[model samples]
Target: MFKNIKSTKTLVKKSLTIFLLAMTAVMFSSVAMSVQSLRGDSALDSKANKAGKHKIDTVEGGIERNFELQPPMIPHTIDKYRISLKGNGCMKCHSEKAYKKEKAPKVGDSHYVTRDGKTLKTISSRRYFCTQCHAPQTKDNPLVDNVYEGI
Candidate 1:
């Protein structure tokens, strides 16, 4: 009638310019296929891409606590132990006057508190760095699935 409303307004402006040029060619082809898959190749290394050297697991005894304030895995063999910044050889048998004459295993009471909870009598220069939260248990197994059901 007015030339069918100017051909239905040029068919809704050519269907909204072909749906905005097919959504700008699918948003620039998904950012050019995410910058061509992040320019391909890149996995560096560090035993994660495994190839050779990675055998250092001989620490006999301790490895149990995986919860309840978990931090007890030294077992033995700290290879030439020396927690640096001067000395510490694991406080020569877990300090507390050398854990009952080096029978070992003392140094608890939360290592004498202090990180604002303040209960120090000793061992708290921010817990005098004992491998920054104990670790050394190796013999590897469970690199992933842990389930962890503890309190």
Candidate 2:
């Protein structure tokens, strides 16, 4: 009877060991299949691969804003347009004078208002640099999963 108890104890110990080992293997396998970075298999410290070059395109209407009060993005390529202190090439089409004839959207009325709340005939100096708030649009896929839902 003592021998029988001893053998049962050994059997239970072996079963428990096997169960623990199986659980450990499952945990490791699940972790190995976890999320990876957009940089493919590159290490976090390594430099990311060069992104594919794509032509800048113009949306028929415009890109929808992701959130309220979001700055509008440039739909067309701005590679040739100059935004220097000398002159603004964008004004040729977006300014009030040219928008009517060029069939382009006019600059926002807010651009003519000063920081002091005074209105001006032309774009205020504070809003003169268009690129500061607007970025050229791209169709590139997001580098990682984004769960951001803007209101």
- TM-score per candidate: 0.23, 0.65
Model 1: per-residue lDDT, tens digit, 1-151? Answer: 9999999999999999999999999989876555522213334342243233334555445667767777777776677887777787888888888888978778888788987888877688877887788767545454345786766
lDDT tens digits, residue span 28-66, model 2: 887666755445566669888764576676897877789
Residue 142, candidate 1: how far off, in angstroms?
8.7
Give lDDT for model 1. 0.72
Backbone clashes, candidate 1: 0
Question: Which one wins on lDDT?
Answer: 2
| Model 1 weakest lDDT span, ten residues long | 36-45
How far residue 85's Cα lies from its native spot in candidate 1, in Å, is 19
Show how many residue pairs clash in every candidate, following the order shown.
0, 0
Q: Local distance difference test, per candidate?
A: 0.72, 0.84
Off by over 4 Å in 1: 1-65, 72-77, 82-87, 91-109, 113-118, 124-135, 141-151
List the RMSD of every prediction in angstroms. 16.0, 9.4
In model 2, residue pairs whose N, Cα or C atoms come closer than 3 Å (at least 3 residues apart or on different chains), thus clashing, are none
